[model samples]
Target: MKVLIVDDNQKALVIAKARLGKEELDVLCASSGKDCLEMVRKTTPDLILLDLDMPDMSGFEVCKILKSDNDLSMIPIIFLTATDDTTNRINGLDLGAVDYVTKPFDPFELRARVRAALRTKQLQDQLAELNRNLEDRVEQRTVEINQLLNQKDAFINQLSHDLRTPLTPLVALLPMVLKKIEDTEIKKILDLAIKNVGYMKNLTEKTLQLAQLNSSRLQLKMEKVDLKDEIIDTLDSLSSIFSEHGVKIVNNINSPIQVEIDKVLIKELVHNLISNSVKYMKDEGGITIDGFQNSKDVRISITDTGIGMTHDQLNHIFEEFYKADNARHDRSSSGLGLSICKRIIEKHGGSIYAESQGVNEGTTVHFTIPL
Candidate 1:
């Protein structure tokens, strides 16, 4: 422990330093308030023995200054004064002095008080360190909980979408088999039921995929892939859908960029973007697929001339189950397509973002994957 003995009386300072100095402690002495303040600024003592009456500055003023400044506030101060009045003790305590000892002090009592003050300071310092550690642990736990919740939501959505995909064939076949011998009214009711079942199945599958993607469990079998070849393959797979929707597929991927990624996941990403473009187009909009390679990354963009989003809508377009207010009325979608795209991109250690010039203008989705 480091202790500072401050008093105008040189004899008293010597007496206290001699009595308290020990093998485990180092002692420093100051004969005036100015000298004490300078010593404190130079090296902060763990404990201070201050005198109440002084020529220039009272011990009360010194205590007040030490307590007011955050840097010096924790140094334990014990006052040594000749007066032992109740009001004087109260005033010292109010000024943040920890204890008071009378002048012509007993050496044993002074040593005991010094030990007590040092012990209290140690305990207080330990408690403060413990509180800081506890706060750090709480912050870490909060971050972990938030991550888990996001994963849970993603899983539920993926399960629902996957289960719904196989139901499509059943919905169509069941009603056809039962309709042959039914009357016109019965057939009409069956048709309505079949239609609703198909809708439900589509919704379920999309929701499940969204959930799985968001959970960070969407794994990919990675391989070295040529960007041009992959784009051509994806467009070929969706040629029929494009024709039916009267939408044009324009490819400008001139660069022969090679990257390591999951081919199947990339296919799914392209399919979703193309499908969204067709679904939202008012007048047979075209989709442009393009890519370029920079020094450290490959950039891919999907631009569409469809019903684009507002700035606010673009901000949250990738949030799972987050359907725009306007999009909610369109029963054909379950609002998980873009979120799935985002998850797939992120799983590849990439980033995706959308930009639009408001509704009915156009939208461009850009992503960057590290090489």
Candidate 2:
């Protein structure tokens, strides 16, 4: 470490220098306050021993000037003064001096004070270096995560495109060919082929949608909308499907219940929940939709008069590709519907859960979004 000692008394400067040099420090001397400022700027010593009394400028004035400069402020200053007044000590400390030393001081005490200040400075420098390294590591990890998400999206897009290219023509041409066929066995075989082809196309579209939702790149288009109206519109779009399954939907949500949300995603969420409930319901069963608002959020629920789940089944229902034993053989289910619904609720900054009393009872799906 380097130490700079400033004093108008040449004898005192020489005595202080010899005492500190015994500690194996590189020592420099300045005869006046002006010389001290110039030497500090040039050498940037780690510690400064300043004499308060001087003919040209007081040590307090030199200390103030150094503290004002951002580059020189942190060099620890210790006022070496002959005057032992309490006010003088307070003023020196207030001007950013680290410690105060009396003239004709003990050489042992002076060396000890110098060591303590330098040790503190060393620890501070190490901490600052560690913080910089931590910031760099966080930035690098963010870049790697972004790269992986982009690669996943690219792979999903290509796969969907390949699957759809063949299924599209098969879906359009198979029905036309069936209309011209006369043999009953061949006709039944063609019908089964058409159904399988349609299922594959549906699976491809849903898989791509789920992958996009899972990515960080998806951005929601937020708007203020009526919750009841949105549900009614979704029900209207799927009215024919519900009728074929002998199910009834009773929407009990009131009008003027406004919320800020992404309209398209919410519609998809309601559609999936209702369709899943219908698939598990008894013949001519009913689905009741209801919602209400509290201080912080709006809670909406869809209750189905369908076969309820066991505790073990409820735990894994929202997970991707998870299906109950009964639904495992159902060809219409892709096992991704409820998973997509869960993602949609998460994207809206909300919570979703399912409640079932017991087997053969009923099930209710509840979700909450910010008001």
Q: Clashes in each model (backbone N, CA, C under 3 Å)?
A: 12, 0
Q: Model 1, range 74-171, lDDT digits (tens) per residue?
A: 89999998777788889998888899899889988988889899899999989989999999999999899888877777657566656755785787
Compare the candidates by lDDT and give the number of the best one. Answer: 2
Give every collision pair in model 2: none
Give the per-residue lDDT of model 2 (tens digit) for 202-278.
77877888888888889999999998889999999989988998888888886667899999999999999998888
Number of the predicted model whose TM-score against the real structure is largest: 2
User: How does residue 299 of candidate 2 score in lDDT?
Assistant: 88
- Worst ten-residue run, lDDT, model 1? 210-219
Candidate 1 runs further than 4 Å off: 1-173, 176-182, 216-220, 324-327
Question: CA lDDT of 368 in candidate 1?
Answer: 83
In candidate 1 the C-alpha lDDT for residue 15 amounts to 87
